[model samples]
Target chain A: MHLVLFILFGGLCVAGAVNLLLQRHPINSALSLIVVMTSLAVLYLLLGAEFLAAAQVIVYSGAIMVLFVFVIMLLNAGEEERTTGSKAAYLVGFPGAAALLGVLAFVFLSQKSALGNARLGSFLVTTSDLSRVLFRDLLLPFEVTSILILVAILGSVVLARKEQ
Target chain B: MNPLLTFLLLSILKVAVVLVIFLTAVAYTVLLERKVVGRIQNRWGPSRVGPFGLFQPLADGIKLFLKEDLMPTGVDRFLYLLAPMIALVAALLSIAVVPFGGGQTYKGVEIFDIADLNIGLLIILGITSIGVYGIALAGWSSNNKYSLLGSLRATAQVISYELALGLSLVGVVMRAGSLRLRDIVAVQSVHGMASWNVFGGFQFVAFFIYLMAAYAETNRAPFDLPEAETELTGGYHTEYSSMKFAMFFMAEYGNMIIVACVATLLFFGGATSPFGHLIPAFGGAIVQAILPVLWFVAKVLAFLFLYIWVRGTLPRFRYDQLMGFGWKFLLPLAIANIIVTSLVLAIHG
Candidate 1:
């Protein structure tokens, strides 16, 4: 059952991401992104990170992606405008992306021997567990991220204010 | 007799029962609203339908079902069709976590709710937040300016109020020390009516904030700027017709019912009667079992009545005013409530 769910949603996530990249219209792309995020959330649930799964849907898919969709709608962004780019750019970009993927995959495969296999219902990540980690071990980084968000909000408010 | 198969079957049975009851409740809620609002306006509403309009929802359903389903020119056909279904489905999904009655076991199976996740409240919040996409997509796909404008307003309104809604619940979560709806209600059961977060925990401010935010979240008056008939016609659903229109209507009322249920569970005593310990002597196992369910349903119904009452009594806010109230007033108030609640809990503990 777990394998089936993983295959189904993982395939969906990959398909959604590919569709997101291939979509011409901004709204279509946004919708594809939402699909990808939701599928990823389901994956998180499968991994037993229940709190993280809910947070992923609430913060990422629910709030951030909604903003993205709202902006796309407000701007009435149409199909991607075609533009000719330097051939060298794609040549470097595609190879660089592939190299990065290869390195990541190699690292994961190498570490597989060191890490224990994940069994269903073996590890449960609850809300209390998450909060304990965040508030104790990662308190400084969490506080810093919040401060960074506050700064960003202040900057946007200043930028958006009307001139006297 | 396989355990897994039994679990699946029971879950399916629970889902079917909840959906049927919920859809019927949503239909009757519409009738309740119309009748109450009509009386508020000095008129008899739907009396000719069937015995004080008890079957009015059935009549309305038939009318909607028989009506012509329209597809306007230049609309995004797929998305236009999908939006209402998405809205209704999202609305229905949130009810999976709500414990309508206290935990009860029949034949060694929990029967009160469908899925009782530890993070139930958050799951409901997450699912309901996704409901915005339905309205937003419906508006955009319609290829009508009025629809577009209405959806934009709805998106903004929902996002703004969602903050207040989530923050308002933080105090309740803090007091209960858990995100599970059952746990929250269990915490209240200790003191019965007074033990409610609203009364005993001094969360009246948070309760009020939640009430106001929930009203906005469900797109009820006086915060219903999204579908202001004076300005945007039918708003995001301007181009929808037939069962598609009914879907949006059902989704809205379903959301209202969910919000009311949540409010009752969180701030009221849920299935716990006010008498609490005193009620044991009144009757046997049957009364013990049925009384709490009656209390739970009664509280939810009262909240629905409150929803209709407010709709009848209050005037709609201006769009800008609604935004300002949610962001400026409700958000800060909710934040303050949380701070005060945490401090009190810390000192008292």
Candidate 2:
């Protein structure tokens, strides 16, 4: 029963994603992306990573998608420019995206059973565990990520200033 | 019915009851907010419906139902319809992961209470984030300049604060050593000198950051520039009316309640009694199981009252101030808190 719901939700997510990409209007695309994020949250629930699902919604849907919509709105590019992408861009981007998806699908299919072995269904990632991993095994990467975020902030501020 | 069938039925019934309670709570919460704000402002809120305007929400519901639910002619009809459902679903979904109470035994069979899941906390965060698209879509689909602007601001506010909010919890997660909400409470139950977490050195700082980030993430008062009525004219849902508008309102309050629940669970040893040692007589299995839940609810309600108080007292931040605070101030403080927490934990261990 759980798997059925997962599959149904996942299917909706994938369809929504494809539709999101196809939709010319930026708003439609943003809304569809939200759906995709939601379905992914559901998938996380089925996997028993409830926290991750919440983070997925709060982060991607709440934050990232909002950012996307904000940019679209800020740009003020309405329906007139929605479907104005070049045919060549579509031809190139679609196939490239498809190839990437195929590789991901192949990886996912091969590792499907192994994923269930992690016992993550009940494996809670507490604050301590996160710190241990972050500070120890992932220390360099963690620091690097922080630097990257700082740079992004700097760049956004600079860009906003340039616009002004 | 067979045992399995009976179990499923009972579970469904429980879920139904929870949903009904949440919806009714959402309705009454609106009424409560009006009354509270009115009393605070030295005015009577809604005294026309029933005694003290208790039935105002019901009256409002009827009025909304009777009113024409019209869609703008130029709008994309599908997305326009979908926005509220998305908001409502995302709003209500967070309740499932929240463990309202502890386990109860039946027939010598100990049933792990509160939808006992491994990653309950993560699920709550994930589902709540998805609600952002609802407002974004509503704004965009409405095809009104004000709506678009409102959603754009709201999305920015939610996302920026969300990062700080999630990162702020890393400190608690470090202390608790488990993602499960129950485990967090269990860990919080063991306190040292001074208060629970608010005085535990860097833990207190983390808690403060979490509190502020949560308020911003939920788009509550003093941080609610996105929906500032004077400026944006209703923000993202400027064009929405009837039940659709109600869904957005409910989602906002529901999200607030859930955030408060997370705060209680993480900081105050959710459901555990304060000074469990004092009550030596009641320190048996029953007390251990029951006290934490009471503690948890009390902690959550305290935060809820704080929310109301802030709403009553504080004025909304300017849009620039809001953004600047999150990026320039809160983000850096959160990072520092995370770094400081790890150092303390390392020394103690």
Candidate 3:
């Protein structure tokens, strides 16, 4: 059951990624990105990271992607003009991608002995438990991350402020 | 009966029953709003069809079903069609986790909610956030400037208000110490109305913030600048007609009811009677199951009535005022509420 569900969402995730790359229209691509994010959230849920899954949807697909769509709509961007010929990129890109995939597979295969199998649906980490780790054990790091985010927000506000 | 088959059939039957009741409730709520708003304005709302327009929703549904579906030229056809379904589905999906009554079972199946997951509150928030897409996409796909502007404002308003809405709920969650809707209600059920999160938990500030943010989130008036009929011509659904337009309308009301249910559950102690168990239980198991549902419905009705009253009374906000109120006022107040709540909890403990 778990494997089937994983395969389903994983396939969907990949398909959405491909569709994102293939789409000419910015809004269509943005929508595809949302599909990718949501499907990834399902995968997180299947892994028993329910909090992460909900946050993933709420933050990524919900907030961030909505902004993406909003910007696309506001800008009224037209479809990208297609160019037929990029011979050098076609020759180099495929081999680079293949090599990357090969390297990833090789690393995973090499680490297979060290990596123990995880039984699906057996592992569970509720939000309370995760909070315990974040709020107590790693409180400093969490606070620091929040501060970093605050700084980023201030930076964006400063940058976006109109000249007066 | 075969066990698996029985389970499947029972689930199917349960879903169908719930959907029928829910949709009927949604339809009537619209009628109730019109009637209530009408009465507020010193006029009869809809007395033409069925006594006092009791069947007005039915008539409206039929009219919408029979109308021509007009597609505007240059509209993005796919997203134009998909948007309403997205909105309606998100509205319906969020309600699945809301517990309408106490745990009642038939053949080992829970009767109230479809799924009472532990992360029910988060799920609802996530779904509500997703629901924005329906409006945003509707505006963009319509190929109309008014639709685009209305949708952009709506998208911005919803996303901005969502921050305060989530923050306000954090106080309740802190008090309950659970994300489960049922658990949150149970926390408040101990002392009935007195023990409700709004009163007993010292979270009334949070409650008010939630109420305001929720009004903005669900696009209710005076925060309803997105569909401000005066300025935006028909807003996001401007290009939509017939059943398609009806779908967006239904989605809006559906979202309103869902918001009302959440308010009831989070702050009003859900189906638990305000009088507490002081009123002695009487009658058979059937009555026991029903009494809570009655209480729940009554609370939701009160909330809906409040929505109507506000809609009738309040003037619409300017776009700048809406944004300023949400960010400058509600957001900070909500944060302060959370701080005070946490401080109180820590000191008390």
Candidate 4:
């Protein structure tokens, strides 16, 4: 069951991410990103990060992606204009991307012995467990991230405000 | 029986039952809304299709199914077709977590609900949030200016109100100390109606905030700016016809029922009868099993009536006014309620 679910959602996440890059229209890209986020959320659930999974869906796919879609609609963004690029650029980009993937794969494979297999129903992370860690161990980081968000909000408001 | 197989079979059975009852409830809610609104306007509502319009929903369903499914030119065929299904599915999915009554056993089999996850409330919030995409895509896919505008308004309105909705629920969760709907209800059931979060936890403020935000979340009257018929024609569903249009209607009513059920479970003692303590003599197994379910259904019905009553009474808010109310008024109020609740909880503890 675990292997089947991992394969299904992992494949979907990759497909969705590829679709996000391939889609010409901004709305289509936004929708693809939502699919990727949702698939990631399922993966999070499978790994026993239940709260994180819910937050991923609620905050990322729900709120953030809605804003992205809203902006795309408000701006009436159309399909991306295709442009021809130099052939040499593709040669360098493909090889560079492949090299990066290879390096990441090597790193993951090297660490595989240290990682535990995720068994279904073996671990369950509750909300209280998450809150305990956040409030006790990561309090400072949480506060700082919140403050950063506030600053971003203020900056957006100021930027969007009309001149008197 | 194998435990895993039993669990799967029971879950499938529960899902089937809940879907059947929920669809029927949604169909009747539409009838209820029309009849109530008609009476408020001093008109006799649809009495022609069976007694007191009881069969109106069935007749309407048949009509919609039989009608020509129109596909307008220039529409995004895939997304336009997919949108209503998204709305209806998300709306229906939220019902899985809602506990209709206390846990029960029949013939040595236990059933609490369809699937009561520990993080049930958050799951509902997550699913409902995704529901926004249905309206957004529907409007965008229709390729009509009116549809696009309506969906834009809907997406903005839903997102703004969703913050307040989630914030308002925080106080209830804090008081319960668990995310499970059944646990929240159990906390309130211990002390009966007086200890309900609405009355005892000083959550009247949160309850009111939730009520208003829920109105906007479900896009009901006064907050129904997305489909403001006078301004945006049919709004996000302007280009949809036949069964596709019916799907959107079912989705909206389903959402209303889900919100009402959530409010009841969180604030109104859920399936716990107010007189459960007083009537100890009548606490036979049959009475114990049946009364709570009746009480639960009663509370949900009352909330649904209130939804319809408000619809009949209030005029729709202007677009700017609606946004201002959600962000400027409800958001601050919800935040303040949280602070006050936390302070009180800390002092009491």
TM-score of each: 0.97, 0.81, 0.98, 0.97
TM-score of chain A in every predicted structure: 0.90, 0.69, 0.93, 0.90
> Could you tell me which 10 consecutive residues in candidate 4 chain B have the lowest summed lDDT?
B105-114
What lDDT tens digits, residue by residue, belong to model 2 across residues B165-205? 87888888777767777776666555422335555434777
Judged by whole-model lDDT over C-alpha atoms, candidate 2 comes out at 0.76
TM-score of 4: 0.97
| Interface RMSD in angstroms for candidate 1 | 0.5
Best by DockQ: 4
- Residue range with the least summed lDDT across 10 consecutive positions in model 4 chain A: A113-122
Identify the leading candidate in terms of lDDT: 3
User: How would you order the candidates by DockQ, starting with the best?
Assistant: 4, 3, 1, 2
C-alpha positional error of residue B244 in candidate 2 after TM-score superposition, expressed in Å? 1.5
List the candidate 3 regions with Cα displacement exceeding 4 Å: A85-87, B1-7
What lDDT is reached at residue B169 by model 2? 85
Count of residue pairs whose backbone atoms collide, per candidate: 0, 25, 0, 0
Write the residue-wise lDDT of candidate 2 on A1-164 in tens digits: 77688679989999998998788877677768877987887887677655566667766766677777778867876763544678899889989989999999999889998875644244555445556787899999999999999999999988889543
True lDDT of residue A44, candidate 2: 74
Candidate 2: which stretches are off by over 4 Å? A1-10, A33-62, A79-164, B1-7, B47-52, B105-114, B191-195, B199-202, B280-295
Error of 2 at B8 (Å): 2.8
If you assessed candidate 3 against the hidden native complex, which CAPRI class would it receive?
Answer: high
lDDT of each: 0.91, 0.76, 0.92, 0.91
Which candidate do you rate higher for DockQ, 2 or 3?
A: 3
